[model samples]
Target: MDTASLKKEIIAYSKTIGIDKIGFASPSTFEEMKVRLYRQQELRYQSGFEEKDIEKRTEPSLIFDKPKSIISIALAYPSKMGPKVISKKGERRGIFSRASWGTDYHTVLRDRLKKLEEYIALKMPEARFKSMVDTGELVDRAVAERAGIGWSGKNCSIITPEFGSYVYLGEMITNIPFEPDHPMEDRCGSCNKCVDVCPTGALVQGGQLNAQKCIAFVTQTKGFLAEEFREKLGNRLYGCDTCQTVCPENKGKDFHFHTEMEPNPEIAKPLLKPLLSISNREFKEKFGHVSGSWRGKKPIQRNAIIALAHYRDETAIPELITVMKDDPRPVLRGTAAWALGKIGGQDALEALQHAFSVEKDEEVLQEIRKGLYFFAEKKQG
Candidate 1:
């Protein structure tokens, strides 16, 4: 295909395939990016992705054996639900993440990509194409930026002008040579709202994130919540959307991308009471397919207990007592004890003592005391 015609056909085909944005990138930029990536990883900024694989990620040969061009795609996750409503939907009334409030994007994006691939295959049967959606070792964010979609924001999320940082990215690496698009100019000149609003200070001052400090990462992590950070978590049952909410660039751009009329009010803003009483079967029935459900019912349940403590609502004491003993997971049991203590009062203190005897680990003992002190101070009252 001639350069002019190929670019036209690719752009036309990309829109037809349902991708919001499309761009081509020359293979050479991939090689240059590899070098820069190594330095970034050495500095400990890359999100816990295995840095040892950096060499393979930069190698164009690895991405496409005979690669000459890259086709980048963007899918927007615009939801009308405001930040406060979206975050609490699942556990409050019990719903899903705003992104998962509608159909799962994985299936939606893939179906569209399949159509793009079939068209390319028919156009040139000898040509080959491989598509990935947040799958594979390629530096996807870097590729998308180079492909001229958007620049990486201070929160480390790609920020598109039209959709802000709410767009999901995917790509198709191909052997077909297509004209490359110019990278977009960085527009986040001096904005730092995303950095300042981060609950755990994960977003650094200069557009990078320390993922370990990220509340989103910690919430999704399997296993125990560290003793030090437990109190800092607050009521976030799933991913923390604080950074995105604070971005000035995202203001007034309401684009809810679903046919659904409005967010399910039940999950949008719950009172942190019913979730503590949710049975495993009920938890599954409510949140199983949602994005936050992947960590299973345990983490969400554990978070609910923590939120009760953070909120300091004594009404949750009875429920907390039940979770402190009968909850199957020891970490949940331990957190429940800690939460109970934070709620204070005689009942909460007695439950902590009971939990302390059952808990063998010294770490849990420390948390138990932290909760117990609330009553110890109150006893002096």
Candidate 2:
């Protein structure tokens, strides 16, 4: 069997199937990454969204037998919003991170992998294969770095020379012993732009990240946001793009090659007030197609309230009061209370006082008191 010739064939076929970039690497144990993972765990910096099993995450051989090589793939997504984006005066909008702007990359990449796997299976009938996108046990960035897809930028994103950091990564672990490609050099020397621009200082030193402090990680959490992060969140509904947006490598890099990845302006930069009142079914119908909707509407709605507060949107007060008083979830009610305080006025003050009297939940009551304290502090000033 001419394995090298087969590799050439696969690469050619990958281009036909809309894969932006492809690279091959040996599937050895990721020794260095294991150390970093353990350190992140020791510092209690993990987002709790990652796979808990460190051994399974770093060792590809455990996932698939005789895993000789890994084939990493990348798809470029558009970084900028579409032309028809609405920017109104009274009603402000919240931005979803660039990754979540398009149709879910997982679905798109999975389809591409299925095609690659099928093509390889026909060529080598006995070759076993396993593929994963961002959700898989193997760290996508680690695999990408080893596979010569891109260098790991200081922002913790894989910076492809052609696509910058605006690319979706996925990989295939195969039993084929294809020759490995050379990894890209770390080109982010002395550049602290991503680190300095990060809203929550999630970037620790150069490459390490405290996931707990990252606005991207914070946006996905299903509980109450810490007070410090609330103001830092700005108007983001899901994920944070400050690091990538600030990267010099990412400058003038916006690709609209894949049709599935085009952003719907309304969904990507949605009105803050309308999000607070969206029903469960309505949330799904509108935002279920986007990647940011994975945690469902609760976190997004909570963040929307915070975004409205960040904007000091007096127009959103009615919706905020409705959520504060009538919402079933204590997290929402509590967040709404905090936002009302931040966006304070006489009605906001009255609402906080009224809620303080009847709100039974300790957390919500605490938030109401905090809301009223805003006025007290204002009066003193």
Candidate 3:
């Protein structure tokens, strides 16, 4: 089999199926990445969502027997959304970060990878392969960097020249010995824009990230947001985009190549108040198709409550009261109490005091105390 010819054919086919960029890489151990990951682990900077085993994450041979190469693919998603949906006055909207703007990218990229896998299988029936997207053990950014898909940006994202940082990345491991492509150069030198703009200072120095402090990672947590980051979260419902939006490379790089990847403005930037009371069925039906909804409704609803406080939306005081007084989940009830305190008013104070009389959970009681403290400080000032 002419491996070169097969590689050429695969590249051609990938473009036809909506893959924005494709590259081949050797299945060598990611030594540098393993070291960096070890350091991150030592510092307790990991998001706890990644694979725990470092060997399986960095060593290709551990995953696939004598794996020869990895194929990396990038699919561009829309960054510049369509027309804004106007929310009525006294109503505020919460934003889902750009990565979650469209259909769940896991489905989109996995579909393309499956197609590629089939194409390869037809050429060599005995060839073994393994595929992965974000949830997989192998780091997609590391694979993309080695495969020439893009350069690893200061924001810790793969920044392709053509699509910028607004691209979804996925990869496949194979036993085929395809020629490897050259890695991209570090073009982010001297530009501290991404690091400078991180809302929570999560970007340490320039390249490394403290995921525990990152707004993007924090927004996905099921518990109450840390006190410091609650205000930093702004109106983000699922993720944070300050670092990416500030990246000069991502500027003017919006691409609406796939129709399915288009953002419905209403879902991407939904009204904040209504979200606090949305039923499980209603939330699923409206947001089930989007990528950000993968963590389910809890985190999104939690962040929505935090966002209402950020806006100090007086109109949302009643809804916050309902969540604080009646929501079954302690995280929701506690977070609502906190938000009520942040968006201080006579009604917010009254709700917190009432909940204090009947709230059962100890953790929730602590939050209620914090809420009332905000009221006390306000009155004294």
Show pairs that collide, candidate 3: none
Task: List residue ranges in candidate 2 displaced over 4 A.
Answer: none
Residue-level lDDT of model 1, residues 1-381, one tens digit each, is 565686687679877656778878876646666766676677775656333587767766675788878788887775456555433322333333455554456566777778888887777787788787665667778878889989888887788898888777877788888878999898888878888778777876656677777877777766678765577777777777778878877886566653432344455445576787777798777665455676677777777777777777777788888877776667777787888877787888888888778877776677777778767877798
Cα error, residue 356 of model 2, in Å, equals 0.8
Q: Report the CA-based lDDT of candidate 3 relative to the real structure.
A: 0.92
lDDT of 3 by residue, 1-381 (tens): 689999999999999899999999999999999999999999999999999999999998998999999999999988888888875557789999888887889999999999999999999898899999989999999999999999999999999999999999999999999999999998998999989878888999777999999988999999877789887888889888888889999889889999888889999999998888899999999999998998899999999998888888889988899999888999999999999999899898988999999999999999999999999999899
Clashes of 3: 0
Write model 2 residue lDDT over 1-381, tens digit each, in one string: 788999999999999999999999889999999999999999998989989988989999888888999999999999887676664667799989998987988999999999999999999998999999988989999999998999999999999999999999999999899999999999998999998878788898789999999999999999988889997999899999899988999999999999999998899998888889899999999999999999999999999999888888888888899999999999999999998998899889888889998999999998888888888898999
Off by over 4 Å in 3: none
Between prediction 2 and prediction 3, the one with superior TM-score is: 2
| TM-score of model 1 vs. true structure | 0.86
Error of 3 at 158 (Å): 0.7
Candidate 1: how large is its RMSD? 3.4
